[model samples]
Target: MTIFTANPHLLSTLAPFICFIVTVICLLTSIKIMRRYRHKQVFIILICGLGTAAIPQLLNAYAASSLQAVPESLYIISTIAGTISFIIINFVFMKMYAIGIRIRIAPILLLSLGAAIAIAASFLLAPYEIGGTKALGFPVLDFYMFILIITMLVVTRHIEMPAAYFISLCVMFSYQIALMLHQYVFEHSQPWLGALVMALPVLYYFLLFYLLLEWIMERLLTTYQSAILDGLTGLYVRRHFQKKLAEMIARKPAAVIFCDIDNFKSLNDTKGHHAADQALQQVASILRDEVAPHGIAGRYGGEELLGAIEIDKVKPQTIAERIRARVEQETIVTVSVGFCTTKESAELASLVKLADEAMYYSKSTGKNKVTSYRSIPAAYKNKA
Candidate 1:
């Protein structure tokens, strides 16, 4: 506290300088993300907001550092620019949320633009000189901020929001309150209060930066998931499954279970693709759930699912049977399950082939049953 008061001019100059630097960093980062991610329009608005906000900091820094008195008109311009920047930044937040929830934002945009224009015009048209130790438009800015906080609260109350978003809103509310107090109550009397007012924007911008990073990480994760997982069944795709199976076998003896839905083509032809897809999804879900703890489950192809389990952890035959029973009991269609353990063949291709042969045996003999590659009769297994 003493340090803040000891060098009020230095603290004031440093605070705005730091804020300007932070704003520029955030602006550059936003532009980079926008270009890299190709979110041109949203980032453009954000850049504009940051750019507007930076102006006041620049002006404040110059005013604090300069020996001569800065013109009142310049201070007026800074205040108006800062206010408009706040409006734009809040509008960007609302617009992002609206886009996410599929709500129309054109009305919000128009209203925000109108408010910004009105604030600017009102401040400019009013005849006010910088009276001794008095600032201009404190009441107008305070009223404007009050309205914004209330509107934002209403928006947040109705919609579900992330913790970061809620925290950012809280920061914004605190900033507005601090700003009002500093302008009216303290009137630059307390150095600590001035420091706090300047620092809050840095915190708010930092939170915004964190939010942007979170968004980028989420997008990357989504892209990776889509690449490795089946879009319909939520199981691993064939290529990724094979890669996982290879890794699993390299470590320990494993089992590969192949499951094909019984009469899937007939189901598709008779009940339509929708019914067929539902059956596939149901069967895949059962396979995925049952095998999840022990190992991996994936969609090998249409109506064909595969599961690989480390035999030391769980019995593949038991899992295969459970999958068959679940499909029969829970779904409109049943599955023929066949599994081959690594004891039979260590090669990946051979294990898959043996599992396929066993699945065919179950299919040809009866539908809705499980078959072990080791249990198939020699005569049936040898049949070309």
Candidate 2:
């Protein structure tokens, strides 16, 4: 204890306080994220791991050189427990990525318990005297540490995550390895050296907690986006069209183009569902290629697509004609387009309905032609 206080190493005395703050912060942050994200259980396991490592480090720090005569056996047992906890936590983290969240609690607890037992038994019962069997001294410690590093790297590579987490993990492991090698070969056992060791994992916990927050945020954004997109065509769905229409009405200068694949049902019946799906996808691709840059093209319904674009000086019919021409040139399948501009109707839904009517007119007059409702007779428009 006197040696630790007198030691010049800044890492020694500072380690416990640093560990305490980091562990508490990580615990609070993880709990907060779990509540906000509602992706619990896995995060709970992670927090437990951080707790296991942090609590023992604190205990070891206070008891290491005190007159209470902390048994070496206690240190060994605590280290074993902490190591087992870490292994279980990492395994749980790994499981989440592979299989997704667990719905059943029993199987999850069963697996976690089994993993913890196996890891603990390996340290407590093994005969080889793996990595040295004391605090960060076991050869198995190195093996497990190496495995954890590799596992973390592998997990990071596959999962979408922030750069901060991987960088922190790299620093944490690098220091651990350095400390282990220093202890094993140099015979340097200064208690202060343990401060840096404890701090490293705490840093890892903080970074991981932040990464989890980011992960949850990203998932929320993705869900929001998917809600508005058509699953089949990867284009805007009808829901998105209504939103775009509202914007167009506010701006008062946009084109609405309605499109329908010619004889799509017949084609589907002749070619079978798979080919029809491929044809639909191909048509969607062409539509996206032609209109997506200038406007938003979305699958409105089966065999129907809608697009809207900002129109400055040019007529909406011109925009619609261009899209129709591109679809004809790009794919064997042709689409009939009907367009109306905001000058004709300010209401978004009315404009889209007008466009749909015009498209139907094109189908009636002839297939694969672009038409507008401006010139068509009211009776013909009514029929359309």
Candidate 3:
């Protein structure tokens, strides 16, 4: 509070150093994200924009701290660089919103045009002299801010933007309007006003950092889901399902149910791969829905689905019969279903093999019926 109430000149002098630190932090974070994520275009653009934005702040900090007089040409160059960097940062926001279109040449052209305009504006606009202090002003930046707000509003109408990003944009827009009012309408440089102006950028950068982290987390989650789930049936892949089954058997009494589509090869040969794939998906969907409450289901292999359930929760034979009946009634093909309870064999491999043997017996005997390992005769089991 005291700092805000102190001499406006002192606060204004410290603003550059504070802004420089924040920009460098954001630039470093973008670089780290790029290195870890294989150099995404958004991270690269953020790094470039932040790096450019940092230059003017560094120059201003140096000029303010130095005892010797700084050259007017250096000040002009800093002003032009700051204006151009602002344009680049605005373009970054636009790029984020319109991700479907790859904007390669427009940004480069806009940067070049912005540089020319900024250079001309710096010379054409006279310096603002207030309270015996001279400050360089760029009226063009205010106009640019107005255009940016309008463009962003239009872009947001067509594209969905994250809440954090929209909030950051609103903060920047409000700050720009307030800063314009302070500089042009009221024409005052009060200590509180200067401090308010300097503090808003830090908040904006923090929001930007959070938005990037959210995006990275979403990508990681999507990749993880893709790795564990089957692409065609949306069931767990064989390896992950086995791992889950092992854990389940270790905890309590469980049963393994194996299902194989009947006449899958014949269907594939006559009806084509597309039709066969549809049948597999339909059967998998039925297994997934029926078994999800009591256990887990997976794609064991081509046209083969596997499930594991705790015996305490529900009967495995009932679930298997439901799956078989559903496939027979709803899909273009039938399934031979078999199940082995933990009472028979608790070991994961043995349980799966026994269930598969029972399924094979069903396939050989009938084709669309369900078989429990306990129901098989001792002679047949001995032969198996």
Task: Estimate TM-scores for all models.
Answer: 0.86, 0.74, 0.82
Please give the lDDT score at residue 279 for candidate 3: 94
Query: How many backbone clashes can be found in candidate 2?
Result: 7
Give the TM-score ranking, best first.
1, 3, 2
Q: List runs of model 2 lying over 4 Å from the truth.
A: 1-44, 57-74, 99-140, 147-169, 188-199, 313-315, 377-379, 382-384
lDDT of 2 by residue, 1-384 (tens): 011122335455455555556666766766776676566777777667667666555654564334243455555555555555555454544544444534344644654465445456656855332135333345445456556666667756766434775676686567657556545554345454555554666566566556556666767788987998887788888887788778766875887888898988988888888877877788787777766656678888899988887777556677777767776886657888888777788887788888888898888788799888686788886665
Which pairs of residues have clashing backbones in candidate 1? none
Candidate 2 residue pairs that clash: 130-139, 131-137, 131-138, 131-139, 131-140, 132-138, 132-139
lDDT at 349 for candidate 2? Answer: 77
Q: Model 3: per-residue lDDT, tens digit, 208-322?
A: 6677677767777889989999999999999999999999999999999999999999999999999999999999999999998888999999999998888896898889999
In terms of TM-score, the best-performing candidate is 1
Better-scoring candidate (TM-score), 1 or 2: 1
Query: What's the lDDT for all of these models?
Result: 0.76, 0.65, 0.76
List candidate 3 segments past 4 Å from native.
1-22, 36-42, 56-83, 86-99, 115-119, 128-132, 189-196
User: What is residue 67's positional error in candidate 1, in angstroms?
Assistant: 7.9
